[model samples]
Target: MTLFFAIVALAFAAVIFMQQPKFGKMPTGDRLERIKRSPNYKNGAFQNLSPTPSFTDGANFFTVMREFFFGGDPRIKPTDTIPHVETDLRNLPIDEQVLIWFGHSSYFMQVDGKRILVDPVLSGGASPLSFTTRSFAGTDAYAVSDLPPIDYLFITHDHWDHLDHETLKKLRSTVKAVICPLGVGAHLEYWDYDPAIIHEEDWNQTIALDDHFMAYTTPARHFSGRGFRRNQTLWTSYVLQTPSMRIFIGGDSGYDSHFAEIGRTFGGFDLAILENGQYNKSWRHIHTMPDEVLRAAADLKAKNVFPVHSSKFPLATHAWDEPLIKIVQAAEKTDLRLLTPMIGQVVHLDDSTQVFSHWWEGVN
Candidate 1:
């Protein structure tokens, strides 16, 4: 009965594979009930600000998969090691507010004496399996040990790239509190994080972080999921208002009217950190193209903009350097100030005269 033995072995393998902790548990009980009450939830999932599709017209999943595997450009990833600056984060002056990016969407900030970490996928890869979606050379500069105890950890959604299970597991003791969109707490809770320290909110909801800091959860035209299912959790952008600065932490959004609405509601932002990479024409509705990033900055009326979501993983078919090159070109057409800091380099939050070198140049 060789065939019978093979079937039994296959079933056992499938069961073991499904038991990995990274798959995470879904929301239930009160959490599910609360999610059901959200105004944006419909048809058993969360909805975007506008009707959105995972793929553009005429681009189906199989066709896109074929292109990704067989027909994409070879230079989509860099051939040389990326250049970066390594600044010791813990010793930075607390009085001086600054930002230090750790490539991709991970960054650390100190604004008005509060330390903030956002969407940190710092475990060197963005996928559940360590081999896939690995960070580019020299981009995995920061580990969990590199960070000081964080005051607030903000998670925009439950996507593997953003809500990394390995990274979060290591950060359990260091994170003071977590702020994420609705239903994302289930994953954190499943990973042994304290439920009391995790705060979940719906869009348009506001939370007072302390006497001097407040955060407003805003809408982003994106979807969220970590597994076969999608959009079961709300995706969000955020407005961080401190005593002296107002920053827009745009998690990940496609081009939409929500940016202008947010600007009007909050009277504009001092700094806007927007997504500007991992985009494909086939899935343009969930991620911003380079030109759309500039338009989004204009729509937000951001006095200064830092375009991130590039220079880390080769998530799309474009060359790793393309997002930066296109964004620089688009920025020249507008008067808006652009911040392009190297990974781990310090960015002064209040210094208007500060300038960063174009480090992306001369790199292969």
Candidate 2:
């Protein structure tokens, strides 16, 4: 009887822990009604354009878990402190069109006089539980306190790393508007944000921020969920168009024809920011490989390409420096200009001639 009671107590505690606010509330009421209306929604959850298995052929859950736990690379986490710059974002001149990356898919950009924050996860951990997926040393330099008043917050999806609940809660007061994919607004509303400012969009929909600035929600071959239920919210990429420059924000995607489709539709882009790490053959249909990243850039017809989504968290088994090393080598054969900035390094948006150092070299 005592053992039974102790087991029940433990289960109760686990339930309570999972119910914490950071877990975020799921779509409900009218939000669910709207979600059901989406053409992309079917069989009770959002579906990808292409059939994307979380694991590929011959890959089982138990096998993958075992490999991740015991057979992964030793260099998955950096041994030395990853270097970064500390920029004064709040005080930077508004006219200076620049971008500051905060590592692992989070970045700040000033374009067409609009201040944009994308997929910001500054809570130091990418997982729901703070103890897991922690950021590398010196990479946690930009906290919510370091941010300026944001004109637009772009959340590509609801992944724990990209749509961080703790960071969003703290950023509520500073953000004027949030542009997210469909069904994602549910989380923001649950967090007490004004519904009027949370703009949710479907694939191929366009939001004209003004005559000079427009945002287009494009397709991404990825999946999304906060908990056990998957693909409840749409994952996406974005095309941001200004009077003088067009940019493609490839949030998280696998190699697909959508890159070429977007390139054709938009004509071309000045810059393309794409995911370049945390990938394996076990899940090849979801995350692009290093070589595939270059192909994606070429498909987008981007003049300059910036590879991100690595160097902070150890989400895959590859050596920490492998992505950088492979991508740099692959880029040499292509005409596509690559941007390899350190965390917090400011990149001038309009300057094609600007240069950045290969900061990842020789660092442990």
- Model 2: per-residue Cα lDDT at residue 164: 92
> What are the per-residue Cα lDDT tens digits for candidate 1 across 76-141?
888899998989898988898899999988899998888999999888889877789999999988
Per-candidate TM equals: 0.96, 0.96
Q: After aligning candidate 2 to the native by TM-score, how far in Å is the CA of 279 from where it should be?
A: 0.4
Q: What TM-score number comes out for model 1?
A: 0.96
Model 2 gets an lDDT of: 0.91
Computed on alpha carbons, the lDDT of every model, listed in order, comes to: 0.91, 0.91
Clashing pairs in 2: none
lDDT of candidate 2 over 2-120, digit per residue (tens): 99999999988878887887777788888889989999999998888878888986897887898899989998999999999999999999889899999989999998788899999
lDDT of 1 at 76: 83
Candidate 2: stretches off by over 4 Å: 1-12
Q: RMSD of each candidate?
A: 2.0, 1.7
